[model samples]
Target: MYSTQGIEAIATVTELRSKTSALIDQAKTIKTGIMIQKNNEPEAVLLSYDLYLKLYKQLEKSSK
Candidate 1:
């Protein structure tokens, strides 16, 4: 997720299945990625599309 520290929020795989909309909103509102856990271990990150695009642009520039 942006290669940054600090998680705006966290949710388990089950929670993600049930509260996907809410979790997505939280990510958007906080403008930071949400750490998703599976088996109590961090497995993925959820980020708002805008934030993803911004980070992607930064990565592209740095790679040039």
Candidate 2:
């Protein structure tokens, strides 16, 4: 199961540009996800690539 807590570090599209690096740093430090917002509404998510790849591999193995 996944938790929304990992994906709630939101930043608007405009602010994203400036905060992107910091966001990445945060994700790296926390080993979690972040939510991106557009117009004050949730739009997308940012996840730790390492975690995503790990989960992906698990799913791939399970699907086999």
Candidate 3:
């Protein structure tokens, strides 16, 4: 599933590249959340399914 306001927090292109391994490592530690950006525009989200499904259910209800 795709998200519009996907991943509130973000990591820049450089941060993502230089810290790719670190990012994944962090992901394993905590429920990681990220919005990959290029030139300050949202490109995509990187988040765990646990958090995703939780928020997805919330959005689904709010739309009603």
Candidate 4:
């Protein structure tokens, strides 16, 4: 099952623009992902490199 607990933070586009570096560092440290919002809607996701690769591998395996 997918869990929402992985989302450690949420940021608006403007906020993310200004704190991009810090937020990315925070995500890495926390080992969690960030949800990016635009116009109060979830438009994107920023995931840690390890988590992203893990998910990618899982998808690839499932597709095979």
The model with the greater lDDT, 1 or 3, is 1
Summarize candidate 2's per-residue lDDT along 1-64 as a digit string, tens digits.
3345645466678777888888877766555567777777777777778978988999999999
Give the best candidate by TM-score.
Answer: 1
Go through the candidates in order and give each one's C-alpha lDDT. Answer: 0.87, 0.73, 0.71, 0.81
**Candidate closer to the true structure by TM-score (higher is better), 1 or 4:** 1
Model 1: weakest 10-residue lDDT segment is 1-10
Better of 2 and 3 by TM-score: 2
Once superposed on the true structure, which residue ranges of model 4 sit more than 4 Å away at CA?
1-6
Between candidates 1 and 3, which one is better according to TM-score? 1
Worst ten in a row by lDDT for model 3: 1-10
Q: Once superposed on the true structure, which residue ranges of model 2 sit more than 4 Å away at CA?
A: 1-8
Q: How would the candidate models be sorted by TM-score, starting from the highest?
A: 1, 4, 2, 3
Deviation (Å) of 22 in candidate 4: 0.6
TM-score of each model, paired residue for residue = 0.88, 0.69, 0.52, 0.82
Clashing pairs in 2: none
lDDT string, candidate 4, 1-64, tens digits: 3445567788889989999998888778666688888888777888879888988999999999
lDDT of 1 at 3: 36
Winner by lDDT:
1
